[model samples]
Target chain A: MLSEFDLIKRYFTRERAGRASTVLGVGDDCALLAPTPGMQLAVSTDMLVEDRHFFAGADPRKLGHKCLAVNLSDLAAMGARPLAFTLALALPQADADWLAGFSEGLFALADEYGCELIGGDTTRGPLNICITVFGEIEPGHALRRDAARDGDDIWISGTLGDARLALAGYRNEAWLDAASHEQAGARMHTPTPRVALGRLLAEQKLARAALDISDGLIGDLSHILAASRVGATLDVDALPAGLALQREDQALRRRFTLAGGDDYELCFTAAPAQRAAIEDAGRASATPVTRVGRIEAAPGLRLVDAHGVPLALSLRGWDHFQQ
Target chain B: MLSEFDLIKRYFTRERAGRASTVLGVGDDCALLAPTPGMQLAVSTDMLVEDRHFFAGADPRKLGHKCLAVNLSDLAAMGARPLAFTLALALPQADADWLAGFSEGLFALADEYGCELIGGDTTRGPLNICITVFGEIEPGHALRRDAARDGDDIWISGTLGDARLALAGYRNEAWLDAASHEQAGARMHTPTPRVALGRLLAEQKLARAALDISDGLIGDLSHILAASRVGATLDVDALPAGLALQREDQALRRRFTLAGGDDYELCFTAAPAQRAAIEDAGRASATPVTRVGRIEAAPGLRLVDAHGVPLALSLRGWDHFQQ
Candidate 1:
């Protein structure tokens, strides 16, 4: 096996160091970045652990991509333009194949989003991937949960319930059709970050509050309501259910949509007057902007069906500590 | 026990939310940071794991401080002014007392350096702490390890080997005076990042290359040499040995200085003409800068005694993966 230094130099440093807004990149004590003038940097961190976040036999490439994508989702929630990131990786052993695939996936997404991998530390330990992403947004314009008002519309991008269904063995060889299996697996593995839509929302000053749906839509959306000191009434019929719900009963579909996590979709609130503009922007960008809910005057989350009847849920969403 | 959200809001968010540079802090999907104009951002990350990096019973406050301090050392090596940081922590359980002490230590240092803990994520897993520190430097002037030249003078800030000595029980409770033990413990726990000295060096453009000594002076300085494509020769007698070596045999002292890690001091190279200026800056800042070696035309590290005899060692420093 290659020594740690050799491994880092051979694989990690061999890539062409992209020009950064920072003054320095790799081969430095720290990466120095120059934030664009009039912009505030958005920062978020996430950690993915083996077994806890993924299966032991999961593909390394997908692991890397998902780790970064989750952080990007956080930045997207704040309407921040991708800039750069740092990765902290701990592994049980050095696997050349794994490293290659992982780096390929990580750099591919980074290249797509124009976010450079700037600085990081690697260590030997149980498999853990921690990433901190930095992005930029104009001062005073970062989408925040506390900005949501009582009368704003709550919007979510992309279809819901697919990722949760994927997690429920619906994508397994025994349960899924070939095409459905492929689609579900892809959704589980390489969920796209809503960076473009986030940037557009920020540029247009459309979103009052925004966040990505990582925890179930209901659970995460509840966070916005709590932070804004307002209640919300989600229109269950307006939720964009995915292919996974095609064969499911209404009850199952509702459960899946309400409790699905890992969707990597943007959920934001907009003033009533701005809804038309937001829908237009989403249409132009080829991204869905479904108005699934509305902020209300009370202080707790509620779901209403097509007939305006309350839909009850005994559970909310994934809580890392609850289990 | 507080739920995850409540824990974050009550403990993590309260201290880091009010910093002037923070446009938006906790309770949002991401934190927004507005950098002061005329300053570039310095970014660095470090990860610590249970068993691998620390004992399970290690003091939470010390671990928190050391984790943040290690990243700060990276920023210091780049000659940056500390600004903010994001933390990703994984723990098996949430211990209220441990969390309180940990956050206290983190925020104490952060307040001292004017850095805010803008964002973080906590989850249930084996203990893993990953901190990414952000700092500011003058545009285009961050120090880097690839700038050393053949004729530069190598200098180190403060004394070395104390942290390793402390870890080995050499300066532990029974072996040292109370004051000495306290000082040694401080070295191992709350290391001071040489931020001011680094900033002064960068502002004056005095250093050609720089790095923080985390993996021993010899090993980390070798990094500078490798990056700069140059060699270095150290004067054995000029090494700044600390109280940890006061009563030790000369040979053991030399070994400690050579192979010891965890000394969060700055090792840098500067042209001979800049030596006086460096000393002046060090004196003004009350930080010692000692010229311990010189860069060479060759491309490998060498150690020489007073009579120019080479010192041989079986190992150079700590390698994270070495069994």
Candidate 2:
């Protein structure tokens, strides 16, 4: 077996996207970064574990992509532009093929966003991938969760519930035809990070509060409500469901779209007046944005159908341990 | 059992030092940090896994301290001041007592250094702890491994081999009295990161190249040699052995002192002219500095006795995967 150092050198060290902010990259006690002047650094971390996160034989390439995508999503929610990231990986062994595919998947998305791999650690154990991403944003421009205001429109980028649909298929909770399975699986495996959309929203000052929907729409939206000390009236019928999920029954579609986890779409708030500008920003980034709800002065979330009639649902967001 | 969110809020989030640089800490999608305008951010990450990095049932408190200590040691090696850290933790189950002790231990050290816990993720899985630390250092003053120059004096902070001695005792390869075991175990469990010493050396420009000794002295020092394209003549007999290891036989002591892993002492280089200044830095930091070698023009390490006689020793540094 290759030694730990050899494995890292062969897979991770050889491939890097050089960024000016990275004063020092891997192969040192610490990697030094020089953030652009007058910018605040946005930092987020995420961990993915085998079985608990993905199945035992999940594709290494997709796994790598998803790990970084999740972290970048956090940065996107903060309306920060990707700068660099550090990866800390624990593996059962130094499998050459696995490392090659994983690094390929990782660097592919990283290079797309111009995110550099600054530094990392490798060790032997049950497979776990932890990544901490660094991004830069102008001071006071971050789309903070606490900045949501009354009468702001809640918008979601891209479709939701597909990743959860894929998960349901895996668990045999829902039957999926081959095409639906393939489409949903792709969504689960390689959810796109709305980096450009987020950056555009922040740079153009077109959004208020923003966050990525990982723990279903309603559950994640509640965080913004609590943080901003406000509430929301969600238009459940208007949620943009994945094409595959739309083929399912209405009840199943509602359940998955309303409470399904692992969606990487950004749920952001904007004033009604900025709708045109927000749409322009989305068009510029080439991402789809859907207005699904409205911020309210009340202190509790109220779900509604197309007619503004109240719909009672008791779905909670995903709590890893609680599950 | 506590849910993931509850566990995090109950333990990790409650005890944080309010560093001025942190704009938004735990509970936000991404923590916002305003790094000092003129300084660079030094970043490093480490992942510790059950049974691989530590025994499966190691004390939670010590495990917590050791996890952050190892990362802080990296920052110290770079001559940076700790600013903040993000933790990504995986647990088999939410044991309240364990979480309480772990957070207490983690916060105690963090508060001492004023390093805030900016953000983190908690999940259910086989036990794992990954921490990425961020520190600040003035540009051009970082103690990089590639800065070692020929004719420089090699120095070590405090003693070495005690952690290895403790491991040997655990493995039944060495005999230790109760008191010796306690002392050596403490060294292994709760290492004091030489942050102050490293900062003083950098701020005062007393050192050139430096790295914390984690993978044993010989293995890590060779990295500096390779990076700087210089060689070193190490006085094997001059190495400072841990207090408990001092009673061991000459061969054992030499072997462990030269190639014992888990010693968090700083191995740094400086010119002969700055020896007094380096000593003063050590004194100011309350750390012991011992000169054990000299850099040479040739391109390979040479081991010598106190009388300058050549010593033939075959010792390879610890490689996690190889072990």
User: Which clashing pairs does model 1 show?
Assistant: A21-A34, A22-A32, A22-A33
Model 1 residue A165 lDDT score:
71
lDDT (tens digit, per residue) of candidate 2 on A1-323:
89888888888885445667989999999999999998999999999999987889889899889999999999999999999999999999888989988999999999898899999999989999999999999998898999999999999999989999999999999999999999899989999999999999998889999999998888889999999999999999999999789999988888989999999999999999999998998899999999999999999999999999999989999989988
- TM-scores for all candidates? 0.95, 0.99
lDDT for each residue of candidate 2 in B169-233, tens digit (9 for 90 to 100): 99999999998899899999999999999999888889999999999999999999999999999
The candidate 2 chain A region of ten consecutive residues with least summed lDDT is: A11-20
Candidate that would win on TM-score = 2
> Which parts of model 1 are misplaced by more than 4 Å?
A170-179, B15-17, B170-183
Which regions in candidate 2 have their CA more than 4 angstroms from the true location? A15-17, B15-17
Task: Report the lDDT tens digits of candidate 1 across residue range B1-323.
Answer: 66677667666877444667788776678988888886888889999988767777888888878888898999889998888888888878878888898888888887788888888898877789999998888876778888899889999999887777676664342365566566766787778889889989998898979999998888898888888889999987788887765556687678768778889999999999998999998998788999988999898888988677887755476778774
